[model samples]
Target: MEGLEQWKIQAEQWSQQALQYIHQIPPNQLYAALAVLLFPIIFIFFVRLFKRTKSNTIILSGLSGSGKTVLFYQLRDGSSHQGTVTSMEPNEGTFVLHSEETKNGKKKPIHLVDVPGHSRLRPKLEEFLPQAAGVIFVVDALEFLPNCRAASEYLYDLLTNASVVKKKIPVLLLCNKTDKVTAHTKEFIRKQLEKEIDKLRASRSAISAADISSDFTLGVPGEAFSFTQCPNKVTVAEASGLTGEIFQVEQFIREHVKP
Candidate 1:
């Protein structure tokens, strides 16, 4: 008890000395000292906060029968899980890539959301776009011509979305069902979509400024509509969700989500 009392007394003396020393310093110097000491603490706090809040979500979207659901399941299960019916609601999950489950240590989990391709349910995409690390627009490679216009329209909307455009989110035009002999090549699909989008651009531009519903316009005016003209990074790749050939999709995810 006596030793405790002495320790308390010594602490009080030290506190008093600290106060005296602080009082002896000039006001400006003391303020500068406080700032110097606090800056690193504040900086570290924000850095940690950002890292904690950074999203690992990847959004999968496309027209119905585009194989998004198949891809989603394949990523999570490493298998197509047999026949996959059309998804009516968003199929959401957080998991490590099934392919990565077998190899190596400490694989990061991905937050993947497969938004329904039906037009009615596509609105749900806006909810996740703000937090998405990247977007994969799955296209039906086998039926590319029949759906090219609709796919281009959907892709245009995504490219112009406020969140997607503002964040400069990277987009992957994934041509699904590439394993099929009739599947269109990525180069062909890309050129066709660009042509379709170019036509849409001309039509949409005729509308008055007040009537433009899209948050941003696509491509540069008076120039041919090309993926390169987009403010964000747009890329095209081929994949077969059913055949479990999705290395490109996995690469895109890791590029944005860091594992």
Candidate 2:
């Protein structure tokens, strides 16, 4: 009878010990599980918030002597002369503008990028273009029909080839050195560009039609903006008549760059 009683007592003790051991859990393990569940949620919330608040980037690209540098300086300082072209190669820069709109009764800040205007550095320009929300193509008004024509053609081809640009990037054209050409009105410049753009569109359409018939690959259509004739001329050198064209370019950007 004593042995039976002792065995019962031992069994009860073992049962109690087993229950305590099973109930005991480490605090560190609980904390680790909580962290694993909550960390991704917190991280995702911040990432979405950042995406909502981020500003868009704009790229300004063209050929040498296209007033890109002048525009950059003018946009940054509010005034600059259309000096001799300093950008023989590709370059990158930024400008900031304060914008106010009645969107949920709040104002916002907008950021812009100014790029060099060199034909040889087109590959570099393409690299930055994908991030651009808009593009500003600056042309020297005095050379619009002659030397500027080449630049215009280059711009069209570049935009058409870029996959990102194929989706209708807002483009603004700034006609610099307008003060030098007495006979050239804003309308004249617009008409000239419109004609050129139409020709390019017609050619591209024909090529696409042919490609379809021949079962060959066709490229993106060339796109150009409805010409906005801006007379951006300021005298950079008193004797050279290289006026400050950058301010005019900036004004155009401020008016046209979409949020």
Candidate 3:
């Protein structure tokens, strides 16, 4: 009992000393120190709460003949094999990017799907969209102008899909096959698609169906359409599967899918 009393007395003395030291500091300085200590804790809590699981599936979609298959083969094998055949079925695979493979060993693989541009097979995309880490919408830059409206329509439908909007799925408007000198620039294609979508938005709104399944909408109300208005991130990049100039496409994939 005596030894316990002695230890308690020592603890009280040390506690008093610590309190004296804390009280000696200015109130403002104490508050500043407490805030500095708390900031990281608060920041970490929010990050954990908001951070989503890293999805491994990356979707590659676009109109037929936009070279989605070529890009897929290029990503998987680092080659176009000098030709391609359109598959009406979804070309799905999980493999490490051939571009990232090194002398040491294979890098992390991704679930990539080349959904046929044909309307009949495009529905297969829904099966994977919920798990998609990112989506690459390939555009045939060489024939952009001729297919601009169709491309825009397809893109609009995609952006408005509930899966994409609710999950804030990032979409890369990848302009492919840029090796051809006559191919359009990414900037030109983005603008044309935006303008086309704006017109479609107005026309679609006029014929209101009470049963119209509402998904996400495009652009600001009463304002011109642009990618910035999207709730999800939308970006445009250029690539050429023919010449293997696909750095930006690979970058986009790694940015969202990792490794």
Candidate 4:
């Protein structure tokens, strides 16, 4: 009888231990399950938030003799210089551009990047171009006739080969040094660009027709070719040889890229 009583007490203790173990399992499993499931959800939420918050970048590119540096400084601090190149590295100085744009009646700030124009620094430019929401191509207006062909060729290649910038990137062409005598007017520059575009079309036609050995000598019809003016926010002005035109360039950028 005594032995039976002792056995009963031992059985009660074992049952209590079993109950405690079972209770512990559920809470531990609940936490473990939450950890496994909630991790991915939290990660995705943060990733989306970061992507939404990312700032847009704008890249400036042009020839060595072009006023890329002068314009960059002017755009940044209203400082102007003639016949000089910017020797700074990427991300240097107060390169951040802030502006206000009405989006659903709310204003936002946008970031812009001023890229180097040297051919040797092209790789660096390529890296930044993909991130740019737009591009500004500066041309020396006074040297347009003499340098138009080369400038256009370089511009075409840069615009065509860059997979990221080719299709959707908006490009603005600024005819610099317009304040000088003999500097082509905006209309004249547009006309010259139109002619170059026609030449490019003709070249493409010839290349395409050559594939089947067809008549590749067909000329591009002048009527079929049209000049679509890059959306102009400001008039071209003389940037060098006297008088400051930096403010004009800054105003144009401000008009387009509202941050």
Winning candidate number (TM-score): 1
Candidate 3 Cα lDDT to native: 0.90
Please say which candidate is ahead in TM-score: 2 or 3. Answer: 3
lDDT digits (tens) for residues 62-128 of candidate 2: 6667566665655555445545456655545443542223335433333555555555666666666
- What is the TM-score (0 to 1) of candidate 3? 0.78
| Order of the predicted models by TM-score, top scorer first | 1, 3, 4, 2
Q: What are the clash counts of all predictions, listed in order?
A: 0, 9, 0, 5
Model 1 global lDDT (CA atoms, 0 to 1): 0.93
Sort all candidates by lDDT, best to worst: 1, 3, 4, 2
**Reference-based lDDT, residue 13, model 4:** 100
TM-score of each: 0.86, 0.55, 0.78, 0.59
List where candidate 2 sits over 4 angstroms from the true fold: 1-50, 79-84, 97-112, 163-167, 181-183, 203-259
Worst 10 residues of 1 by lDDT: 78-87
Which runs in model 4 stand beyond 4 Å of their true positions? 1-51, 86-112, 162-167, 204-242
State the weakest 10-residue window (summed lDDT) of model 2.
231-240
Q: What digit string (tens of lDDT, one per residue) describes model 1 on residues 200-229?
A: 889988999899778999888888999999
Give every collision pair in model 3: none
